[model samples]
Target: MNTDSTRRWLALGALAVAMLTIGLDMTVLTVALPTLAVDLNANNGALQWFSTSYTLALAAVMLPAGALGDRYGRKKILLAALVLFGVASLACAFAATAGQLIAARVVLGVAAAAMMPLSLAVLPVLFASPVERARATNIWITSTALGLPLGPILGGWLIDNFWWGSVFLINVPMVVLGAVAVAGLVPESRNPDLRPLDLPGTVLSVVGMLGVTYGFIRLGDEGWGNGLGWGALIAGAIVLMLFLGWQRRTAFPLIDLGLFASRGFRWGAVFAVLITFGLFGLFFTVPQYYQAVLGTDALGSGLRLLPMIGGLLVGSRLGDRLLPKLGARLMVAAGLVALALGLGLGALTSIGTEYWFTAVWIGLVGAGMGLGLPVSMAVAMDDLEVARAGMGSALLQALRQAAGTIAVALLGTVLATVYRSELGDLNVDPINDSVNSGVAVAKSTGEAGMLEHVQSAFVSGMGAMLWVCAAISAVAVALALWVLPRRSAAVGADEAVPAVFADVDAPESTHVG
Candidate 1:
């Protein structure tokens, strides 16, 4: 291969590694959640935190880290992130207690914060033309999306046959190979005019995010009736106000507050958050319905989700095709409507429902996600000047993860509440006793009524959670319409463009601090 061809191909491969790591980390731990809860002797709420901790930390750090990449070097940040991620994965694999595992997940999230946005932004830097850039981005999105949903399938198989830690252990070789490729092939680059880190804005953003996320998680366990839960939700909103004010005052903001002025960026962020809320939240519940109710194993549950994954691919391809034609506005709105319809149908699903039938509905959800995610992301970044691409990508990534965290936690609480209410009020004593002592004895011994009641309660509660997802998705349609208009960047490229992300049509230029 010629020098240019060699560099581009190598960079793509390195980026592939980053995408794989990120996609895998998201769903793999989810499959293992039940196992961790049982083995660590932790409660459902604690299990919820295991997921929340990682997402919260990841969301909190993403913007700050993205700025760091622009200020320092992406290659440097990417490589360091891989190393930390690998080590954290190993630590999680060996963790003997829930606390240890949650701590490890937190570390993993911090490391992963760089891998997502940096990888996305790096693609434009690698390819030289709009056509080439578009193609490269397509491949990146396809591979990453494929990897993300497959994490459950992969984890299911590993956990069903091997061990919970195996899910995490899988990252080891990928990281090793990825790190080597990135070190050797990815050249160092940065925006020379990167402003100082937006510390106040970062703090406020983190706090706001954590508040809302924690509140949702609490709902999973405590329900909205809990004062602490409502307080947290309200606090998150208040902190968000502070964060916005800080952004306005900062000379060099963590996020270019100006990017939101772009119709594409604003709508894209809205769609990104909504998409995660629908898909990730849906993914969390399906496995339980499969294994807990349908009596399928981990592998079977994930394999059953194959239709949704397929839908995602179709939707993604379709969205890509429609993007340049429709621009972002109509495409995202259509995608949101599709997602809402799918989730609305999915909520009606119940135990003993035909497996094949469920697949079709799942496909609808998947297709909606497929169309919404990449379409919005492409739109958000479409107007980005060369210099601000990294920051733009980071903000988008943080928004996506934040949305995912909120979805899982809030949905979790909703599910818990519905289940309990369905049971006519459940107590832990009966559940623990029956499941632990033996079903037959509990039935013969008088626990049958309570046991059946709780199980029914769980089913009902799960149904309620699904409805909430549907409503949120429906609301997203309005959000998309309002936030994502058809317009160019509110601030033109002149002031925002940093030296590094020069247009492909321009002479090839590299920047150094």
Candidate 2:
């Protein structure tokens, strides 16, 4: 209705575009992995690095990125990040070897680390009204959700028609447009009372996260008995314990440990992490099932996942309305119930099951994620002072990423271990490598039995993995019910917005320095 209102919504669009790039990057590379393996002459190890490098780099810098935005300016950092992301995307597109691509991905991850938190951090400053913030957040969630399915569909089409590099190159025009829009629309905001950077705390947090993340990743790659993996896990756990202790003692800590005192922040964070744990784990397994067992091409598989995106949009809309009425507790609890039911259905899927059965479960899980994730995320941010918005958002996202990484690692290990054990004494070297490798081998040798065996083994592993996901969702439901706050308490913690034309006012700039 008003000019200022229009600008803020437009600003949110720019932020959403930036967020969309990050989400697209997450899944876009996945479909190209096989192409990369051949074109780059990559071994299994190097192939894993292409993905892991990005994730590790992103995790390592998140804590610091948030502080940097708070100390300087959120908009300034976001603009710079957009430029860096575009440059990194170009590098990724032109990479000639696995090593070069991995290096490029690391840069892309660091740029994304800065954008992700600051994008959400600006929300508190943008839409001050609680009702408006909820609706804005739903749109923000949808933009990110839209990118997930787009990656597979778009990446599949690019890989099918063009080269593998085109997937990364496509990000260039979008990022450039996003940077221009953000520069013109988004306001500069930072914490005037923010303290100097805590150098020691920063180092500790980085070390702790990197060590833990690497250990889990190694566990997936090399298995449980690897000495290096065990050593990394032990060392990471010890370092993280020390980091927690330091956080408690530090004068100007990297993150305020006191924020955990609020039940809303604490449990909301846990539920958020659980949501990613299931979602990423499912994504990790389901695509391969489509390609390997169902004998579908990349494009077909990507198109098949469209139903989940539809469910996510519908669920997000429901969350925006239900969160205000049901409170965080009941709404998230219901979502987790839906998630568990969906996972349970997925666990029952066999090798020859129809696509519609899978779609029903996938849609349910997506809907659950749509409902649960935003409510929990908003609850985590609701009580945060505007000054700590960056750090709070960073902490929430960092934790979720960590959870997703661990979920993928653990669930992948489960699938691999069960598949291998079930296909014991196969004596088929190619078959033991992976489902894709086994299928290729089977077709080359013209052995129908081999394909059947591989399919059966993989289905067993998938079923077991989905059951584990269902169990986790069940636990999340109980935690949501037990720990989430009532409507009155959650509303009491909701931050208030000053008038639209207050002293700190404008269409272009809103918050004070």
Candidate 3:
């Protein structure tokens, strides 16, 4: 390979490392939640915030972050985001309270918001060949996918061997490496036509997302009788409607409504959101099931997730090879089928369910995610023009992040409601709060029946949540088959190639300097 080719690939590696950090932070908190609940004296609401705060911030800031990258320089914005990510990770490590950690996670989310879009934007800038770009994109997607499952595994081991804070500390070295490599290897690129930042749209999106997410979380904790939850949910929905109206009228919109015009972008985005909804639900519940229900340590909880990772790797490999032949529609549909099957099996989980059974269903879920997510993203991305890459990718990321935030909130509500119902008027606040607390109460009271009841209630709640996820996946499968394009656009002389693979055969001069 030539020197330029080597550098370009190396640059992609650095970007992937940065992407991995963002993905790791997404689910790393799942295994840590049980620990945080005890160490930080956090309640169920606080536990939900620990995850949503980060994702909410990501959804809120991503659009502006993309605009910033486009108006400024992608490499410079990316480097700054990387440095801030490292700093935020440090803050998360030493947080003295749950509130502090939640705040730190918000900062980390903002930094990641910048990193996610800008790093993707750099791909078109680096690789001019269509085939090479497709290959590079797959590698990039795999790195991020790997981090989701790996987060629990790595965080669990760290929490077990060292401290709960070690999970956050682990990101420091990776951030440093990504930052140094990015600074040295990546070239700067920006849009010459400055896109005005939509301050009103940004504020509206942030507030609306927070309000809706908090409402769902509040409802979960306080139940349906709480007026605050209902009020917040209604108000949030109204505000989001207003935000959409504003976007349509505004000269400089935070989200480009026009992008939805493309059939590929619209349906690709829908499938992506559905997949994330199920994926986050799994990550949120499984760790607690492993630790609190099955009585495993954090490390053991993480290790148990390995089957899912294996299935994901296998599915991703197959998807990459088959996507060209099967086309986005069939490829995505196949993945959703696997996902629904896995979730359907998972819905049958009981307190006495065997580990092997759990592994089989969980692995299937992973495979389904692996097969669907990348193709969905690629199809959406394929619709973006080179000039709109930053904003377009950010728009997609925002949607996915927003869906994740809502998923955790909604699924958590489902889990808590089912758990409380199964327990049947416990009258004990600690026991009703969460399975972790219920377990603590059972242990303290030395009641074997109480322990059994707590486990049974939690398992029932998990099963209910999985059923909801499976239904969503099934719906997604039908929609994907109906909506996505049947085949990739042909690449031929005198024909316009898909934007993702456009200029693949172009000269090196086509790349941004």
Candidate 4:
């Protein structure tokens, strides 16, 4: 309530805005896809690439980015990354072709790889106590969560009222002012004993991540039969194996694999992965079912998700308060149960199913994720040395994001497969030709009945993915219960905000004491 407190909250607010930009980019781009395809004369594969490329690049560099931030400084890297992100956004606004947009977005993703987690890692240090750190994290999670769903509403408004470029242009002022606010208000911290960048480790990890992502995406298109998909995946695994080997031997590893030796840290990563799988996967699928099967417009489709959104807002707020009271075990377990129940319930939806029927189920899914995300994340870094927090959170976040993308690709592919199988006499070429135009062609070809079947397949695939999410959340819960010390022993571990990431991977650069 005093001036010092006011300044700290103001700093958190600025960081929240930074977090919002990252989530908004993900959702907003989806909303603008139709416009993008038409204006740029893009095909379905190209449109998919728009998102896929950014995701791929983001995942590939996350570990390295955090370390880079740490070795240099979280604040310096963060500000620099923000500047580049804004510039890239401006470029994306004027992107003349699909390739150009993809290029700039890839850059934006690189910047986001740095920005998103750093915001979380950085802001908590501003608050003095463990409770204050928890409260700050609660705010960060809520803002980031809201940004994803809010994107459609905001992007739709921009696209309808102005131009597609307006979406990217919106980031300009946020980035400019965000840089200024953070520089002035945020204290810089770094590992006092920072090491030089681990060049070989960085190269290996990036290649491995890029390969894995490309393989999954290619498989979505060409099936596992495609040699490229299988080859990239195999080679990617090998590269990643090599990267892990390097991590173990190197004096300065990109990620300290040793950290996972703690049961709590390992499970925390699992919890992160599970939440993204269920949350973003459902977020990706439901809107299509709404528009394609139920006949809602884009705006209506976006709005239909409000129940889940409402639940997210409510549950994230409540989860923060409950973590201290319940400890990690009960909270994460309960959240997983809610998530599985919601997804399993959603699997029952069929051709032309009622919205409200699924609404309750979807609401459960959102609420459950809200519970898992914050605590699981906080738990991972709870007991870590301050120097290691950046790498830990970045590692956790990258894994979570990868899980979401894989679910999207896997579920999307599964739906595509099932739709095709049940597609008896539908125009396969049209659907395969372009994601954006497929529905129009399907309608014209007397395949309207098939729409429901495809929708059902997608919902079914989502349920399957949810089962995977449940398993992972359970793993995370186990880690939290076992790895973290007993609740009565010490809660200070929970209170210590992960500055390694803020300070993004490598800790001292961004945070200062």
- Sorted on lDDT, best first, the list reads 3, 2, 1, 4
Each candidate's clash count: 7, 0, 2, 19
Error of 1 at 115 (Å): 2.1
Error of 3 at 316 (Å): 2.7
Which candidate achieves the best TM-score against the true structure? Answer: 3
| Candidate 3 Cα misplacement greater than 4 A, ranges | 1-13, 123-142, 184-187, 321-327, 381-390, 489-513
lDDT of 1 by residue, 1-513 (tens): 223877788778777766776777767766666566556766656767777788888888876776777788878998899999999999989989878988999999888777765665566567758788766765665456456667888999999999889999998888888899888877777777767887788788888988887787676666577889789989999999988888788777766688788766776667677777776667667776666556677778778888887887677677656665665566677777888888877777765478876898888888887666656666677667767565576667667777777777878777766665564434444343212122222445687565455545556666787788778778877777676655333322221111111100111111222
TM-score of each: 0.84, 0.85, 0.89, 0.82
Q: What TM-score number comes out for model 2? A: 0.85
Which 10 consecutive positions of candidate 2 have the poorest summed lDDT?
498-507
Taken over the whole model, the C-alpha lDDT of each candidate is 0.69, 0.74, 0.81, 0.67
Where in model 4 is the C-alpha error above 4 Å?
1-15, 33-48, 117-146, 180-191, 317-327, 383-387, 433-436, 444-513
RMSD of 2: 5.5
Give each prediction's root-mean-square deviation over alpha carbons: 5.8, 5.5, 4.7, 4.7
| Residue 482, model 4, lDDT | 59
- Candidate 3: deviation at residue 499, Å? 16
